[model samples]
Target: MRFQRSAVLCLLALLAIPAAAISQTMDYDRLDARLTRLAADEDMVGLSVAVIEDGRIAFAKGYGVTEIGGEPVTDDTVFRWASLSKGVAATEIAILASQARLNITDTVGSFKTSLRLPGGGEQRATLEDVLSHRLGILPNAYDTRLEDGWDPAKIRESLKSLKPVCAIGECHTYQNVAYDSIAEVVEDVTESKYADAVQRSVFVPLGMATASIGRSGLQNSPSWARPYSKRGRTAGRPKEKIVNDNYYRIPAAGGVNGSIRDLALYARAHMGLVPDVLGETALDLLQTPRIYTRREQARMSSRYRGTVRDARYGLGWRIYKYGEAGNRVVGHRGAVEGYRSFILFDPDRDTGVVILWNSSSRQPNGIGFEVMDMAYGLPFHDWMELDTSQAAAGH
Candidate 1:
């Protein structure tokens, strides 16, 4: 029985296509078919994906519906970027730094922001520290308050009272509410709203026409995927949820919405392909490995652990040493209450994949790795954990 089950799982992972053929080239047609199957297998509420190859969008598609029984999702369907907005904040800050408008090395206390570290730690924390999530306070310090109707300003003000867990720059602490402090920095330096600064610095210049900031940016979209949650009993589909504006309250941390196409262009810009918009110096600073992320390394699956030997955090990105070849892949994953997103790109090859879904399901996370593994000509490892899933379904 065990051997038979293993055989079935292998066939499912291969999806009737040989591993060698799958790795020979970045096959978009095959990828589109595979994504269709994967979305059905995962019962996703809505999904949109874009692949970047040779410095351009090679494949972009959508699967499922905007809502359970509503309109079908298309490439133009807008989905929330969630914490992926961090990369936007980092990129904008880098651009400002290059323009001599603000220096990342400037201390947090130097700016008119509400982030106050214990024992005057904010005096030592720099804009770079905030971007790299080295604030030294507890991880996600005021996220609960931020989610529970507390205004971002008030939550930031309350941070002054919390004791420091580690001194500034001593450890890599992941933050959302605290990380949004960059918004204040951008506002002070640009003398404008953070969203407007991002628009001027990023979206409009990159031709990301569908991209916009804040909750209304998502809700007002003519073709937007409604948020969905997989709660309650055994179900045929996930339940649609109200688009919570809590995360959007922290614009720099979790408030950006766009189509899959916009995300692909954003990734290309980071690869230094869109030089006129983002120069090499700013790109380097945004992606350079700054701190070792031991927590991330521990959380990765055993299969990926062998290939991704090191896990580190850059300005607003996650850097990894992918496969035995040790090629660098910059990527990030994000989750809000009812949405999930993942992006992975190889800067050297100028190849990457971005995925967005309007449900809480995490199944699509592995598709990005599958695409990367094929691009690198590596042997298949079923990064999607389909074997375990098959067992669960009694396949």
Candidate 2:
């Protein structure tokens, strides 16, 4: 009896070791499969995802239908990175600033004399304030009109009519006004348009052969996925909403389009792999937190949970805690009319992930959620694990 008990105990111990080891290794495939299940949801159209591990793209894949009833999104699909453009534009501005070509803290009145703003009739804000959401203009999740639609012109127009909710550096309010001013600043200083700057400063250097801030017409250009809206809606926009489909006019704010791989390449650029479009010092300056936004706490908690410690907003990127001692993790997400996008990297680890979905409404930002989770291999108890445990129970 004693011998039999010992044999059984040894066998159990042996099994326990492997189970413990298995537990340590997260099931990313199952997590991805669970993400795949999201396709069965109501509005998701298509998605492309790339995971960068240790400074290089380790895996890139796409799923779901690119069009409502068309082919599944392949790795080649391009998506509009709405607010994500803020990061790129901010980076561009920062690069220019570092070269003494631009300054975030400079007054907008000096950039364009024709441009009139509302705050104090002559209130000035910095490039950092605008892109980092610290201008304190509004949209502290309060105003409805400022939340959506095409209003770059109106935002620019309102400058002379609006008042600074707080002092120049008092608080952070993520809005379009500062970014628009930055776009104008880019053109004013560079003597070149934002698109022209991107063409010369970034796109060309990265060899982004097909990327552009072209209008909605180009959203469907070669090597791109067709733009889409939430289900039961349009692809581009209500014909009335489009003012100048060419967002480059305000590209410094939110006008960019490119492929998942290309965007990943852009993220890679931030990690110092590609030639310095903005140079190493310029990129370094961008990672520095200009604003510590408690406003983003709730949203970051909801999306990233424990992964995002208190974060600071860089010129355009969201800086999060990366290492055990709160090392900074920098990345950005873009949301256009129909497409949604996210690109982030851990500069210390030289690792990042970029995911772009052709349709923004249906799939939502879950792609960014899952990719970030998987990138760090954060142990999570999501539905996927529940389903896996259940299946194991059955066996």
Candidate 3:
């Protein structure tokens, strides 16, 4: 009958709705169950997560207690982004480049940084090289000095004294001090403090309400999660930790602080959702693969080791091929003492996961892929390693 034919057409149309639109309505019972189990786990002190689909937040929630028995974690509970802050710097640079305010190809020596590479490598090295970890210096150069309370500026000044591991632009040698030196260039060009420029350009325009830079930003939050660890005499029980300002001193490489909501918004903008905040050109510039990261690929979880391949470093991001389809996925993970954060998203699909936890557990690392599996219509896998007691093992 005509009525039956019309009903069939209507049903087909409804089923044909773009996945992004229906993603908002997708049942999250599986995710909720996993998060609930994680929150109650022995090693997980406090955690918050946000899932994004098509540039919209599909789900945002917090789990566990802020400080062992302290306040419950909420989406608004601020947590340190740790090295995840590097992405902010990369994003800002991309925006600046789009506006013709600065050139990433400029030599590092031309800036105000004290990054004197051996054999005049700084002269040969470009700002893009610095952001992409192509400094050819020792990995995490001067990180130990920074943690030991040495003056950050002095630490940067000492980078020139280190030996080169490879020629500049030949290999990916990560650096926190040398990396943070980009802040000086940003300050010079923006005619404002690095943090102020980031605030005005990225955070404010993207509406990252609780996002901020520095130690004060984390401590000053109305509700912030305290870092925790199972070290010392804790008998494997996570204990509250003091918030160290050492890494915060290198605000560009680290020191970003924000809530789950703020991070989700940040990810959404990076997905090219907020055109007013960021455009495709800026996103492309920030995410283009610049250097292969073989060590990074080796560090992947056993579950992902097979599917995630050809790892590479971008401006401040990590790019890898995922799934049987070899889909390009952009992601980054960060850790600082007792806190761990992971962000993974498919820019093409505009879907990703952001996780923040205030403990030394890497259990949540798998959750990002679990969400992505659902997005990709792949079968479920125990990427979270929930069955194993080794979930508390270091990332």
Candidate 4:
């Protein structure tokens, strides 16, 4: 029975690799034409993309205008990073852990005593639990509370009122408040605010000069993309608007704003191209898959269909295993009110892609997949056909 079970598992894994031809070299002209056409077909307001190769940016470009007939989007046009802040937060925590400032095993109650697991159980969730979305809290637990203007301290106190869907480390659920709790941990351990610590440890070290946290960061920036949303079914263009709320309440979870250029630098550091900025052990810990996520599995199963063998959640990334080669892809995507962004990389190849856009109607994941296909030499697919079909049907 044991041998049969093992064989079954192996066969299931083999079924996950898609049959496709591999290219010998990246076709830049084809890639550029596809992206430009995709942007137009999707009615994207403004899009900026950067490709990192061998620890440096190989290609960086922008498309469309920042506003209607206004300034053109550039590689430096800042966009709200949204949930991608979780990746930055995870890196910062890993740095602190490496420096012996904080231990991942420390319980949450140690820093914020008010937060107690339901039923008063002594097995409090640890920092690693929160970072990896294994805190057992229901997905997006107390996110509305934070959005409704409740302070983090009050939200922390309110955690006791909520119940976990499973025991700590038993399952995976995406979170914002639980992830943001690390900011407090950072402040307590380093005697500095989370934003300050992240800037000093990550942004400064990586030379991500334009990267900043929260509302003040966006406000201070002179060249930033304004938020936009689709107006109507056939609006043809997205309308510019302001996201008035301050994400500082949960800055560590979803408050970052930066450009594709800066994001490329961050991705370079993750690829082990910049050893002096980020240590190998730290990056490994951050990228190591901790808890398997059903949400990720379902998403990848639908996205890749026959291809993805497994999908799991790391500290702040979604890990996808694809192709016969079982190439490991680590990446994160983010969405705010009127913006969407995606950053993905193949660490083994030390190549990655960053996509930032101001409009919310169309996500950049398809573009990320295309870039991944190029980086890995996989045969390209018409990723935009489904979206185009949907739009046509709606019309």
Range of the 10 consecutive residues with the lowest summed lDDT in candidate 3:
1-10
Tell how far residue 89 is off in model 1, in angstroms. Answer: 0.4
What TM-scores do the predictions have?
Answer: 0.91, 0.78, 0.92, 0.88
lDDT of 4: 0.74
The per-residue C-alpha lDDT of model 3 at residue 331 equals 87
For each of the candidates, the C-alpha root-mean-square deviation to the true structure, in angstroms, is 8.6, 11.5, 6.3, 8.6
Q: How many backbone clashes does candidate 4 have?
A: 0
How do the candidates rank by TM-score, highest first?
3, 1, 4, 2
**How much is the lDDT of residue 142 in candidate 4?**
80
Ten consecutive residues with minimal summed lDDT in candidate 1?
1-10
Ranking 2 against 4 by TM-score, winner: 4
- Every candidate's lDDT: 0.83, 0.62, 0.83, 0.74
Model 2, 42-93: lDDT tens per residue? Answer: 4456777776554445556677776666677766666676677887777787
Which residue pairs of candidate 1 clash? none
Which stretches of model 2 miss by more than 4 angstroms?
1-32, 113-123, 140-154, 231-249, 322-327, 361-364, 374-377, 383-395
lDDT of 1 at 193: 96
Give the deviation of candidate 4 from the true structure as CA RMSD.
8.6
Please give the range of 10 consecutive residues that has the lowest summed lDDT in model 2. Answer: 11-20
Clashes of 2: 15
